[model samples]
Target: MKRIFLAGLLIFALNVNAQVQTPAASPHAELEQVVGLTEVKVDYSRPNMRGREIFGDLVPYGAIWRTGANATTKFMIDKPVMISGKELKPGTYSLYTVPGEDMWEVVFYTDDSNPLITEFEEEKVALRTMVEPMEMPMNMETFTIVIDDVMADSAVLNILWANTVVPVKFNVMTDAEVMKSIDLALAGPSAGDYYNAAVYYLNSGKDIEKAKMWMNKAMDMTEKPGFWQYRQQSLILAKAGDKKAAIEAAKKSLEGAKAYGNADYIKMNTDSLKEWGAM
Candidate 1:
């Protein structure tokens, strides 16, 4: 009896430790792509055809679909983009679709909480665009979404399932963004920009005259220059073989450094002044 009880206890322990694991019927998939300066992301589940007839049978026509299985399909964009001449702001949205015989309506919804959208809420709809469905020569086993025909300013978002293919074209503001940056750059260099260019030229041994000019402009633009800035100016002047100007700038830097209690700049300026025989 004691042996039988021990055996029973071992069987119970084995049963407790046993676990059954299985693959999901619809597997989750995540896709991310950069369209110019904008980023696009999609998170959804891919359901296989499984030899059953799709479209009009498994997925009924003239009804809104969650666009995927298990969880609501999610679409995210980092920048505003134009789809079918409509603008969509940067955000995460739920993707849905309404299938027809020849056309499909793709939707972007503001609410993305529910796994399945049973009750249709027209108020939460953000954008809806119609796209013509194409028949593919070969069947696609699993549902897939891809960004195809990627260009600098636009891209085609394709949806494939079974033998049907849907393409949606969208445009990004790459040209506008590039033009804005160009305009800002052409406006003029800031004081910090001038200082950085001067320092780079001084360090790179590129045209000491240009470095001297840039450094002077930087100092002129600065209302009350920092000790570090004055130290760099002194170094640039010294490199340009202007000992008198270098000594004058170093003395000003030393005074400012002493006022700011900066030991490193004070030491640097004092050493430069001494090296120039102005100590």
Candidate 2:
């Protein structure tokens, strides 16, 4: 009987060994892409939510959360990111959160010292901001992350989960240094695109003269003074309180728009003139 038991134990051990497996890497992972001329690469991955009710339960309402499963959530930025006008340096940061019923506290932890565990402390934060989550029309079963409406100086960092929509405005400028970068891009290839970007930036309440300077450089390039240049120049003039100049420039821009057969530009020019109380 003893010998039979030994044989059975050996058989069970062999079976268990056969079933054991080793993986090549961690299951938690992300996608990496460089954005902006700064070449800031943002690496992100969707972790296993695993049927967890994100709000008011596992995360708990009115409390801070790391936002997802694993060690404090991480946002790896190769270049610095500006959050709500606050400057953050380029580095790997552990993201923590303060979950609430109406809103959520999004925090950036400076210490990349811990694993994806609830190990972060309040002292480790580099910057933090409370952002209200908007009620999403449709329920989201899985977590989603994306960068929307990217520009030369900013992009909207968006997160959707559990029927909630959260957006964080990420800016590339928080320092005098960013101005230097703008100057550099203005002086580089694709200067026209950079100039056009600057114009949009100013129109949207960003750097005004920076936009003009970029446009000047772009217009100087071999690129034709097409719809983009005309539209931006008109916008700058309008913003400068020159209604007549703006309207005239906008009309000229319409000429360029017609040349390109881009209805969007034509519409934008007409709509903008109206918005500026010009037309």
Candidate 3:
């Protein structure tokens, strides 16, 4: 009887293994974007139109859609972000959508296990916002999501499908991070640290004298100063109204870059020297 039972189990396993399977009609897709100090990621499936109606007919109005083909669409943010002027904490969320004639409701659900919008619980919603849908001039064959119009602290999350587009605006806080990094860097001044501070001061229109001081400190700290660092020193000197010193630094930078076989830096120094009447 034990042998018969083992034989039945083997047959069942064999039948399960012999079952036919194929790839999903919609393929999986993933994308990541870095906005300032924040990292945002999205994972979803892309479904093609295939000459069928998407929004109104196949997907019907006023009904919640999975926003993708198979599995729940995932949205992940490493840091807190403000969406539509509202703050959202850092975490992963399931994305869903409710289609309408002129507008759509975008939902960010804390629960990620629900594959169908019908199964999603309203109590698990993290954020729900209504956005106007823009009609596109041409139909998009496959559903697409992109991070667009990126700036230092802001970006647009664009969703395009069929002939419609929806855009969600978000912002990241980078100023606090920049200030914290500057504080840490000032605590322990390395050669690179001094050089970066000098460059930042030069570009941001801070005190030119302070920029020159930091650049000199960077040059003094390094045993073998790089061509790029010397080039930056030259710029700082020029900004400080010391043309003679700038010309001398440019010459040194050009020679160092030639020794390092860095063609780009050599060209950069050469152009600056010519522009400053060093040649």
- Model 3, C-alpha of 86: deviation from truth (Å): 0.8
Weakest 10 consecutive residues, lDDT, candidate 1? 112-121
Per-candidate local distance difference test: 0.92, 0.71, 0.89
RMSD of each: 6.2, 19.9, 15.1
- Tell me the tens digit of each residue's lDDT in model 2 across 169-228: 777743556678788878666765867587677858977767766765676673567776
Q: What ranges in model 2 sit over 4 Å off?
A: 1-27, 39-53, 115-120, 174-279
Which candidate should be chosen as best, given lDDT against the real structure? Answer: 1
TM-score on alpha carbons, each prediction: 0.65, 0.52, 0.60
How does model 2 fare in lDDT? Answer: 0.71
lDDT of 3 by residue, 1-279 (tens): 999999999999999899688977899999999999899999999999999999998878888887888877899999888887777788999888888998998888898885675755778888888889999999999999999998989998888999999898889988778888999778788878888899999999999999999999999999988778889999999989999999999999999999989999899999999999877
- Predicted candidate 1 versus true structure: per-residue lDDT over 4-111, tens digit per residue: 999999999999998988999999999999999999999999999999999999999998898889878899999999999999999999999998998999999999
In order of lDDT, best first, we have: 1, 3, 2
Error of 3 at 11 (Å): 6.0
> What lDDT score goes with residue 75 in model 3?
90
